[model samples]
Target: MKIDLDRSKEPSLREQICAGIAERIRSGLLQPGEQLPSVRQLAQDLGVSLMTAVQAYGLLEKRGLVESVQGRGTFVRERAIATEASGDPFGWQLAIGDYLPRASFWSQSAVRLPPEILDLATASIHHSLLPLPLLEASIQSALKQAPQSLGRYAPFQGDPEFLAVVAGYLQRQGLSLSTHQLIITNGTQQGIDLFARTFLGPNDVLAMEAPAFSGAIDAFRLSHGHIVPVPVDREGIRLEILEDLSLQMRIKAIYVVPTYQNPTGSVMSLQRRKALIDFAVAAGALILEDEPHRELTLADKGTGRLPPPLKALDPDGRVVYLKGFSKFLFPGLRLGVLAADGALYRRLLAAKSIVDLGSPLWLQKALVPFFQNPQLPRYIDRLNSILLQRSRQVADTLSRRLSPAIRWQRPQGGMHLWVTLPPFLDADSLLPEAHRRGIHFLPGSIFYPGEPESNHLRICWTNLADAELPGALECLCDVLNEAVR
Candidate 1:
């Protein structure tokens, strides 16, 4: 039995060791429950360092591919089947991230755009319009009134006044959460990470809307959650399939962007929201409600109006509200709030404390005066106007030019419009071409939990200026046409 490894290969010996063991498992040389060579023995056989072999074994164990029994040494376990199709895809191919790979690097990608090319990627608020001057003044004022406290770390939980504001904010949403029930996180991403770490374990089901927000899906995948794809149409998650799926799948948690959802601008209909609440109540699963972009929407637009959030309707405290400033507010400011059950907040705050003491006292305090102004919600009207005008320009250009080939919904409030291309094209395949033309749309496949190839794409309206909208849409239409034809 020989393991052929290229010494000069860029992947380190530890990674190579992981790949080697994983390959043998796929080829059936290492059968299920078959004992693996001892770490020391494998180190000697491979002529690599003991640390390298140990790291390799650790990788396999973390991946749920190998198990260690006290006296039995490491043995190949029935490879964790994250995907339960007809047979094991991990057992068959070297396909990376499709179904199985040597190592499950379900890596969350970072999207950072340069100042030159316009970024139509994330549904984020432009920093130039984010009231930075006001925030700076607030921070400086807080610093002046520090009372010898600003220099010290915040009391392990969070800033009191900020938490108070958060509590009040939720109360307005009809949540009635106390300050004790709120946990301040670095951003919405961190709140999501904390939730993912708390409840989900390897291969546990996380039900989500298809063409979902990729950021949340990536978080769940990183947390080792099994992603179950539920379809989403004009009115958020398809309730009929959900009604059927509830009986079959043991859903651990449902992650939803209920209002102005990423990619698709579909808001959950009042009826569907009720069905979801009822289903979750019956299923005994938590609802992770993401309402980051809730404040921005042209409700009076031609697409019509929608209803309130699931958390607003949650009576049993079954819904966990993940609210953040990343969308309508500043993302770089790194501020977000999570509202959970009182006990859960305590646990999560403790968990967060163990992670990083607490969020920056100054930044937390900076958001205070800004949120205090009664004009805050009213300011949303201005943002809606800008986004609405941009959407109109985008819509008209799309209707006049790309009407026949492309299909999309004129999103009532979101920065993005989820559009499906003609069947013959691939969103990912066409993205490189679009990128070359200084246009970027997120591929719909990554938004899918399972490895599903799709022809849909998310177009962010805010990134394009009113004048550039026509030319950009025409160029984009050309790209779509070329990709399909």
Candidate 2:
């Protein structure tokens, strides 16, 4: 085989060689069970080191493009060549079939955007809002004080000091959790995955909010859990329906985002929270309460007091609380906490150990000081203030620009405004035109467990600066107008 290596390219020589052979295998140029040159022979022919050729072959073998025999030489794997020779290049897809779940729209839409496009889909804080100086300082402090953290893996459960800090943080929010009840996760996504895999089984019934977090839906589906969608109003999920469903079906779990729920920024009422806990207790069903944006809320206009999470009200340890730090803080941190008790905690901790051994110790250590700092609350306050301003801008712009064509309730807190368009208009159909006009949003269809409502869409206001909102809204308005016309 003739192999060409570009030394000027970004990929290493080993990667280039591997890619060349893999390409040939995929194109049917390499036949099934066809022997490849020995590592030394390949090295001599390609003018590369024997070790480099070995590494290339090793990667190809790992990729199933090639196989190595004890006495025989490396050959293209039969499956790879057979797949290529079938003339259907996508035959491998049929091998996996529908068993491989499709990614949620939220995940697929999370791509790098052109600099000029208005971003109204991302569920993250802007880089400018991140506490860079504090983070740098924290990293330095962690290295100085707990340099040993970098040398080894953290305990499977989590670092004790980090867990203690997390417990204290949760305590301030009125949910008193012990360190033993907590499992440090890579992020809330992993926590959701762990719960789905550990507590749920194939065809198990999982009750969920109708328009829920796409990631949660994806996780439950991947675990082969059947979803029963309960509708959500401005007051959050309709618990009466949930109660009825629980009574009729054997639900293994109920997942909720009580505080500042995704897509729709609705917070569950206090009455509903208590009722949910009571229902779960009666039904012997677990509640997976995702609270990534719990701390983020626009200041209440009147009472100024927000309802505590369902976890705090849970009397029977029926709630597994997941709190993600990546939303409001640095996204790169990928740190979150899962709080459960008794058998639930043990299972989740064991699952976490199997998933990633444990979260990085240095990162956990660095965050301890960051969370403990007195200025942390102030930082959050500052962030909320900015978000509140942007939220208002989006609402006002929508009202003035789009008017009767669009309807939505202003969120009490959180970054998203779930807007409903005219029944005749499809949000998915309008996305390409909107994109052309330098704007983008998440179509509401992705958030549903059943048939998606094509007229609804979610718009986020936290990622852009205040100056960018008006123009973005204008672009969105123009697109909506054209669509209706």
Candidate 3:
């Protein structure tokens, strides 16, 4: 019953006491049906507060170690004792039961490929396009400036300097938001999870576009949300379909990628954006607006400027906006910003604190200099130009080589293209042969929540080197041609 307490440790006194007793229980030093000291006795013996002893016992009970009988004493639970004889070590895990959603497609998308394979599946700018030297320099600068940040924990919301930089950055993009309205996430993935956990519950309705970002689909589903798929066309998610859905059920939240949406590359028009805001306001549903590729505008003056984000029109704070830096900029940083206001913002902030406390302090500090640099906008402009050229090259190759039945819209700004194959061909069935030919792609079925459209597949033009893109596209086109023929 003797537990040594370390005063200078990071864990509190209560945590240390729990750990010490829990270890003893697990190691069979404290046997099943054994009655430990009472909370008052333990506090007196250990020279600690009675509250600390009570809290430690409470933690032990939570871990299924002990139980208290009425008017008696606290004794170890019979099932708490570890078995000395073991066969299958991991058999205990089976009792935990499975609650996670099916993530087969999402899992496969992250597999490592051979060097010879032309990777058109991952939606990231080519490594050469990223400012690696700048990133490295920023890291060194961060360490030199704030050496303690490496050893310190960041603020729950974000680093103040980084938050200030993000505020100005968002302001430049026409969204007037203060640092208080923002939470810096590990990435847009984390942002989606935070919002889902904060607002959604079991059987709560979450409306999302069919053929949406797979990550969002997985996140909401993991939260046990009953997802309703709305159709997306040239404009965006069909407003009429969403309105009808609102009538049928109380949707807790709507997730949309309005500008340069993933996989589809469809930008919600200005009119559609306004209607969507109005829909959310009327239905009393929150909108999760994911704008990952908004900054990478590939269109010039000929196609006209793209509309501002859905957040711009959301004066009522009905929208939780996520803007990702991983797509067009440095993916390795895994940096993104989440913007919300009032009560919802507080809820998301609390959820984020539970998730990871905060994103890495070192990375957050490193990003500040990068975001503050005057040349950042120039670098993005150059990156967009190259991506635009690559997109045209991909389009040209497809048009020249593929059958007329195959169709795709060249997106104005985005990392990937959503190409629809002929009805006779399924991207899933075609993927194995594609891999055999040293090419890789993401089949479109993975992007849907319910029944998926197997005829479509997403090809990211940003992954391959400029020199290698032509050959890769040629190889892909040949595969599609042979399939159709």
Candidate 4:
């Protein structure tokens, strides 16, 4: 086996050599039980010291990738076998390195909890608040009108009718787009994955908000792109930092959740949106604008209309916009629209075809009438009313129950409240007690791409029933209070 070591690289010779061997084994280039070169031989081949070769092998052994017996050379370990006593029978699969990306933190946090536990971590609306009657009527009407959609596969781009509906819907929101520019995705997450597969390559620089969505972090990581985190404030991502970094290294794409940003519900100012577009044009970079929570506006009419989306401001077609309904509407519908143009649009459509043929034709058919329903806007307004009340209750409770050291700003929209703790307190360390008290929250570290800030957590105020909310808030506050004491 050949192990290439670059002395000029940041990794030490020992680490490079170790990683090379481990990759070879995982990729099946080195068969199980194959004998490895002797340490002296490896050193001589690679022109490294014998001590370095020994250290490399030691690291591989520690990783369970190799084993050495007395009076014999090192050999690759055989696949882990299941035994009656072992807890994990599928452990052997770990070494295969098939390389499917998993969002471990998101998966672990989203596990099914007991009925007694209040799920403050779930960023979804309560069932009672959903427009059940309206949705039922729409689905029944769709079944009567388009029964044949169930038998036929949807077009690779999307259902033509659904595309037309979504195009019109976006036009009302200030994003004028034609039917051909839109593709129906299963959800925004899938749209993000499509972008990653279509545009991102290894070592491509992706600049995103520091405390961004956890799922996006995982999706971008799957592309093996080097993510650069830019801090967010009341105005959204700090462009100055991104501009400075661009000078240091080429940034291929910028990802943002501009309006009603996830975790922290800050909106990017209109001027900032324009500036961002300008920057993208000047730098020749693409902007991936994710607007999943924009429609859940909780502010009063006095707050005026929200800023137009980044795509609305872009005349250069540099922005790829993704709008999802799963957050505020029917989550089971798993519906969203992605708008793009030019070569990137064609590539994304091709990627979607490979991903799932198309997002479910029947569901797309159901959404057409729902999108056209006259009562839809009123229903959204009603949802915001109840959500506003719940958000206020949460903010007021935190103000009264939490220490001044613990802080959070009342969000204008969206389900989550980004809470910051004193620097000495770590949110992850407090999670177990939070769970024991029958409440759950998402630790802030999951939202960050690298070197997370441990002093923050995200709590959603929308998932609990109105009656369960006060008690849930009390339980959450009690954990924080006790921790502070």
**Tens-digit lDDT track of model 3 for 1-485:** 45556566547899878866664554344557666788898898778999999999898889788887655567778854333323557645533434454554456565678899999898888889888877788889999998999899999999999999999999999899999999999999999999998889776899999889987877886786678899899898999999888888898899999998888899899999999998888899999999999888888647788898889999789999999889878787798999999999999999999999998888889988988888788888888788777778888888888889889888878887899988878887798788899899988877887666779999988888878899889889888888888
Candidate 1 scores a C-alpha RMSD against the true structure in Å of 11.4
Worst 10 residues of 1 by lDDT: 96-105
Q: Please give the lDDT score at residue 329 for candidate 3.
A: 81
lDDT of 4 by residue, 1-485 (tens): 44434576657999878866764554345657766788998888779999999999999999888988656678889764222324557645533433333363456454678889899888888899888888888789879999998899999889999899889889988888999999999899999999998889776889999899988987886786768899999999999998999998898999999998887999999989999999999899999999999889989868799999999888878899999998989887888999999998999999999999998888888888988998889988888988888888998899999988788999989998999988999897898788788988888877887557879999998988889999999998999888887
In candidate 4, which residue pairs get closer than 3 Å at backbone N, Cα or C atoms, i.e. clash?
none
Off by over 4 Å in 3: 1-96, 301-303
Cα miss at 360, model 1 (Å)? 1.1
Give the higher-lDDT candidate: 1 or 3. 3
The models' CA-based lDDT, in order, is: 0.73, 0.82, 0.84, 0.85
Clashes of each: 0, 0, 0, 0
TM-score of each: 0.76, 0.80, 0.80, 0.85
lDDT of 2 by residue, 381-452 (tens): 888888877777777887887857578878888788888888988887788788888989888877887556
Q: Which pairs of residues clash in candidate 1, taking residues 3 or more apart in a chain or in different chains?
A: none
For TM-score, candidate 1 versus 4, the one ahead is 4
lDDT of 1 by residue, 1-485 (tens): 23434476557878767865765554344667666778888888778889988999999999777998776577788644222233554634421113221111122124344554455665676654566766677777777776455677776667998899878876776667788778888888788878888878775788998877766765776565666788888788887887688787688789889888877888888888988999899888898998887777866556654587788788788888888877777767788888888666667777788878888887777778777877777667777878777778778877876747778888877688888888777786787687777666677766676544478888776655556556667778777877766
Evaluate residue 270 in candidate 1 and report its C-alpha lDDT on the 0 to 100 scale. Answer: 88
Question: Could you give the candidate ranking by TM-score, starting with the highest?
Answer: 4, 3, 2, 1
